[model samples]
Target: MTPHSVTLDLGGRTALVTGAASGIGRACALRLAAAGAKVRAVDRDAEGLAALERAAPDAVETVRLDLTDLAAAEQAAAGVDVLVNNAGLQVVRPLEEFPPDAFRLVLTVMLEAPFRLIRGALPHMYGQEWGRVVNISSVHGLRASAYKAAYVAAKHGLEGLSKVTALEGAAHGVTSNCVSPAYVRTPLVERQIADQARLHGIPEERVVTDVMLTDSAVKRMVEPEEVAEAVAYLCAPQSSVITGSSLPLDGGWTAH
Candidate 1:
């Protein structure tokens, strides 16, 4: 894909970004704030949230939230003009060995929480006739892989939820879409490298080139900032006509 810079003016928007403490979420929170939005950064990491607050005290406010608390997750989204469901977790294990509890937790935080957040934000968005919902899905949402049943399942569910939200919200000027990316340079992917290495019986270095990037034509990991830019673009007026779509930052993984 050709690279292009996005210019946006969100002077009066209030944006809520979950998993805002680090990685893609951090980049997104800062990017939106730079565009003049009042951002509420939510995450379960207190120290990370504090660090994020210090980085942009005037533009960002931090909220420590564990999405497993479904009620609170919904309550936290109230009155926001933008909602980014970017918080998620993963476990690598064969289905037979996978813990049932882990599967439920993954679905709860990644899928159910997003539903509640949308539910909470919808009323306000409908009232104003404008809102943006960006779900951070993964390439796994479209394609399955070994040892990632739960993560893949949750992402697939998120994709469906996003599409449904788009269909229903279009009439109200509230758009919902997903940013599905391949492996990103994040703490989560870093952790996955080791797990993948062990599971595939390869060295950590080989996991990147042989396992992770095996299908990626670019042969490199995507940057968190790149994913954040896509999120920002979806919120731009230029993207008002785009909804119920999945934009893949897969470096040709999906192209194949």
Candidate 2:
């Protein structure tokens, strides 16, 4: 299909997006809703989830839960046709300085929770003979950088999980793929900038260029909608044949 042929006809589908209160998750929730999917927007922030429900009352259902709770994550995935694993945290510290506790926290949230959610949701999708799993991995998953060991490791593990899920689910018509993006202007990225500057003793300006956009040929932060567009494509009907892949919305960051 041509780029223009991509359209959302998810009227009968049910989508569950974690971390839907803001940034890429929020954008994905809204895009899925606009495309006619009944979206369950999950986030730990009750106020933000409420705001999303208010903004798209007709299109979304709000679920406020901390995904770190394995049971809660599993419950959240139950009965969903599409699972967008977009909830994650970042910790930018040199491996030598990285706290064990902090590393575990990042891994649990980014990798462990998604793995549980996918496993929990699989039976539902398998029974129906259709499903989609969109993991919001990062460009760092493919490459590497200094002072981001935990985040990079979790993302890389997520890609592997996506591949395994794709291979197993392929026969059942449940496609699994990941969208790897460069830095996007999200609250998460904004926080990363401040944290990196303080950790590395560099100017905030340098953080954006020397770190976030260092490898991007486009030299600009990606937009949430740009990433959401890719998610929509993966969730679409035509993407049935597209599985076990990492689609880059990286502004050519990985092209080099």
Candidate 3:
């Protein structure tokens, strides 16, 4: 797909993006920085963060953080004008077989960390009378598939959290919304291929063609830039009235 341009004047804004090491988070960090925002790129992957620094020497500042460290995650979000909660991990297993620790970790990073980050960021936003909290939710937030119990649960929780934030933040000039997407061409998705195949008893190629894309009407994976563009749209000045919404980039997957 052809890449489209993003136009926004975030000249003096400070944006913090979690999971900024690669994939969708990386795309969003670059996109916002291109619009003139000073971006704090957060991820536990020091090497990936280093690559991001090389990609945009002056626009990005890299912070190595594991969202499991909830306090530090919250601290990193303080005083930022924009917060993008995009860090996530996945484990493909049935509910009963899902590891307990993995479940806790998933909820910690994908759900609790966002809550803490928002909690930390809201005060500064309220003081300034403006802020944008964009959670990188998933198609699973609205729909569910087998062998993804933890992921789906966390996303559903995130969706509810985003709505509540929107309501509380409305009067404070802060808007919280979610950008939910279907499978994208990212490292996370690529890794899931083997897991999905293992569980589904199919080859890796078949996992992509049969199980993964089964419900995607568009018949192709969404692009990271595409998701980044949607995030940018929600952050636009005109989007002030567009709070409490979950914009789906699911290729009509939920249409069914």
Q: Write the per-residue lDDT of candidate 1 for residues 1-256, one digit (tens) a residue.
A: 5343788888999999999999999999999999899999999999989999999999999999999999999999999999999998989999999999999999999999999999999999999999999999999988888999999999999999999999999999999999999999999888888889999999988998999999889999999999999998999999999999999999999888
Using lDDT, rank the candidates from best to worst.
1, 3, 2
Give the Cα-based TM-score of candidate 3 against the true structure. Answer: 0.98
Local distance difference test scores for all models:
0.95, 0.92, 0.94
Model 2, 22-85: lDDT tens per residue? Answer: 9999999999998899999989999889889988999999999888898889988998999999
Which residue pairs of candidate 1 clash?
A: none
TM-score of 2: 0.96
**Candidate 2 residue-wise lDDT at 51:** 86
lDDT of 3 by residue, 1-256 (tens): 5354546779999999999999999999999998899999999999999999999999999999989999998899999999999999999998899999999999999999999999999999999999999999999999999999889999999999999999999999999999999998999999999889989999888998899889989989999999999999999988889999999999999899
